[model samples]
Target: MSETTDPDLDDSVRIADPSIDTDVIDRIESALEEGALADGPEVRAFESEFGAYCRTDHAVATSNGTTALHAALEALDVEDGDAVITTPFSFVASANAIRLAGATPVFADIDLETYTLDPADVERVLAERDDVVGLLPVHLYGLAADVSALCELADEHDLFVLEDACQAHGAAVRGDRVGGFGDAACFSFYPTKNMTTGEGGIVTTDREDVAERVASYVNHGRAENGTGDYDHVRLGHNYRMTALAAAIGRSQLERLPEFNERRRENAAYYDDRLADLPLETPTEPDGYRHVYHQYTIRTDDRDALADGLAARNVDAAIYYETPIHRQSAYETVSTAAAELPRAQRAAETVLSVPVHPALSERDRRVVVEEICDYFHNQ
Candidate 1:
């Protein structure tokens, strides 16, 4: 693992470590040697392997998570004046993607316990709105959102469901992976994510139409079965994944199971050690496999706790200090922004410490010790 530490933190324990082992290097080297740097066979193979991993029939590779999301929304035909119900308590990208697709993102309160979209609130939004055309639930911090219930609601309301599974690559609910739950799901391979491809993303789905549309959209709207390479069909963007990123992604995918297991183990250790502490540890609902992209804890004194860790040279960070709806950009875009009290509270309290797969025993111990010392001393 090529572990990176922050010099400003004085070699502190990292919140995440993107493992670029020899396998990834070798794959990239091979691609470089063959001059296969463009969107080609490597991307195709990665898509195939990733689709199989996610239990989906097709996976459309893209330049990054944001593009994957935009492409998916476009494929669903969510356009101007259409509103999509989504959680406000995630990385802004979740809602930003909807806005980028020329649609309005309607805010819904989250279930504070899970830090994910609350189906009840979603239903309420659906009840009050006539413009809602889709559901975009984010699997925040590697916990699978209650997609099953959300999907059922979508069925009743005749709305499309697209999961923002960017933080939940390997997470599952009741033995089934997240990508297959909704109409389509998106995964990110950003450096800090559970896995890394330098930078890349993919859309996983069983629907052939969605897959086809995403593929074309990512490739400048070129017709799949067009007579010529330059034949344009619909207006699209250059969101295609490069061969180098795909090569790294394929290698990372092979190691994802092991990486996720280590994260789970570290989280389990935190759960046991932090049980009696003042802060609230993360929860894994029954039969759900939480991949622990961020082992976040909630406490009213979140800032103090984070400061304490930083002073001790232990890296701790906030995943989303500001909920999407509260951002300056979304202030006017979403009408329900002020209605998400749970999301507002979560933004002020949640702090994620070092729980990446690459953390050493000493690193994890320091994290737990510093956190415990902070509360105990207080």
Candidate 2:
């Protein structure tokens, strides 16, 4: 889509990248020395900071993003036979979490441009289904979904909204952050996400009941901390975030905006250069902000392009080579038989390039040039 590479540049340029700061290392070293690595002060500090960032009243740190989502579903009291509508184009965790929480996941197609769940499609699914709890639209590739319309549908259906915001830590739709739009939001702090805690996740909620439910759900259903050591309120899992992970998360959260900005800057460079290409690049939906987590693009000849990039020693990835609904696990429950054309198209044509924050101007140029060259040869 774009080409601005220097002839002398190397093959290390990528589509997305993660930003790392020495300050994070320093924070980790200090935490380890002070034994502040598990559910410690640093962990508490990160939960507070993350909650504040998401404009929520509470944030519960969990072992992983999947647990964060599970906690939300638990908090909402989702049970067997309850249905949750979600896009099939997202990470399997989105639907998997629903299935794990004893809920049925209804598949929905995504908006072609934003690659997020389509509200129209969501409504159609809801209209034709029953016992639907709510929508769990993912902010795919750091782009926000059509939350306003989805929220309207939820209001009309009297359903709960639990967002799978793991890959969209700082993304916004309609001028509102992903976490702020839903009843509860889940985020992953994996190393590759916009931010990292080494490994952890957080759940945000405005409702005290939901917050308390998730808090208890994460810690073996303990009703009180020091009141009764053996008291168990409800069934729970050991999905707690370790202190070390929280320590790193605290540092990373503070630097999130800067990291997101770097991603945006790199994406801006590609947007300017790839305007003339035959490939279809990502687009920010109306009134939404894209954080460019993967900087994915779609080309009719994705396999050829990927092979070409590989031949040049550049790294390009095919994200979700198979749509989740098409997977064997979902086949029995899936009402549609690989019927999502856009999802299937994206699965075949989409390619993830490095878009991490560690990229330099020279690196961006090389990546763009390699992609442009592949298309030109085709």
Candidate 3:
């Protein structure tokens, strides 16, 4: 088996580093001492701080990004028989969350350059289906989706828009942060993401109704202003974030801007170094801030290039070798047969290298040199 397939056989440059320093440890210890481990003061503080950072009126913390997405969908009242239009070129979680909310995910193509939802294809999807009540656009690889255009299209159709900012913690579209673009946005704090919350996520929204619904949905559907603690008014799940995770998230949130800047710097270095190569580097259009979650590039010879990088002990992985609609889990979905040529082509050609903040100068140099040498030898 190839090193990429066999984890134990791989010894390459680190792709991500979720290192927790003494500050994070101290926060966790403090949270533990507080004796409120489940959705207490720490979680509330993190939500408030994150909301302020996103420039949104409300932010609700959840156990993970998937749950965040689901909570946001439920808060929007998207349920059985309703359909949502979204790009298929993303992690399965994007689609799974739609399904978990009792809605079907309608497939759309992506912009080949940004690898995000194509508003034109979204319009085509909307024209074909009247059941698409919402639009879910994933900010793939830390680049903000064209939320402005998507939201405009949604407005014409009177549909709600939800942003999947799981990979784009600090990314912005037209100078405004991603989380405030649509009706609501979801963010992931996975260790590999721009920020680490020790496994947590949050939903940001300007609407108080959406915020209140999401908060209730994630906490066993407890009534926000009920008579007692067990007053469950609606169906919900136990997707609340722990105090420890919230504590860590608070510290990470404080450093997210710095971390994203380093990632952008590393991506710029790659862009300059790999300019003359045979591949197409990432694209950051005017007014859009790309946080460089994965510094992905596109090459027709993607498989051979990935193998070459592995041989040199450098890490290069496919972000989504299979688009969501093509996955076995979505085989039975009607959108599986949708003709998303751009998304399908991206699945075959896209490759993501190390662009994390943890990468050193030498590490970046090594990655560039290996790729240049690979092309030279060919």
TM-score of 1: 0.97
Q: For model 2, how does the per-residue alpha-carbon lDDT over 1-378 read when each residue is reduced to its tens digit?
A: 112243366545644345556676677777788774555677778888899999999998999999999888989999998989988898889989999999888888888888888898888787888879888988888987888888899999999988888989899876677897889999998878998876789999898899888888888898846123768899998898987788678777888898889888988888888889998888986688899888898988889888877776667888778888988898777554747888888898898887777776666777788888877876
Ranked by TM-score from best down, the candidates are 1, 3, 2
As for model 3, its CA RMSD to the true structure in angstroms is 3.8
Predictions in order: lDDT:
0.90, 0.82, 0.90
User: Per-residue lDDT of 116-157 in model 1, one digit per residue for the tens?
Assistant: 999999999888999999999999999999988999999999
Candidate 3 local lDDT, 214-282, one digit each (tens): 989998998885423899989999999999999989888888988899999999999998999989999
| TM-score of candidate 2 against the unseen true structure | 0.93
Off by over 4 Å in 2: 1-11, 14-17, 33-36, 224-228, 336-338
Each prediction's TM-score versus the true structure: 0.97, 0.93, 0.96
What are the RMSD figures for all models against the true structure?
A: 1.9, 3.8, 3.8
Ranking by lDDT: 3, 1, 2
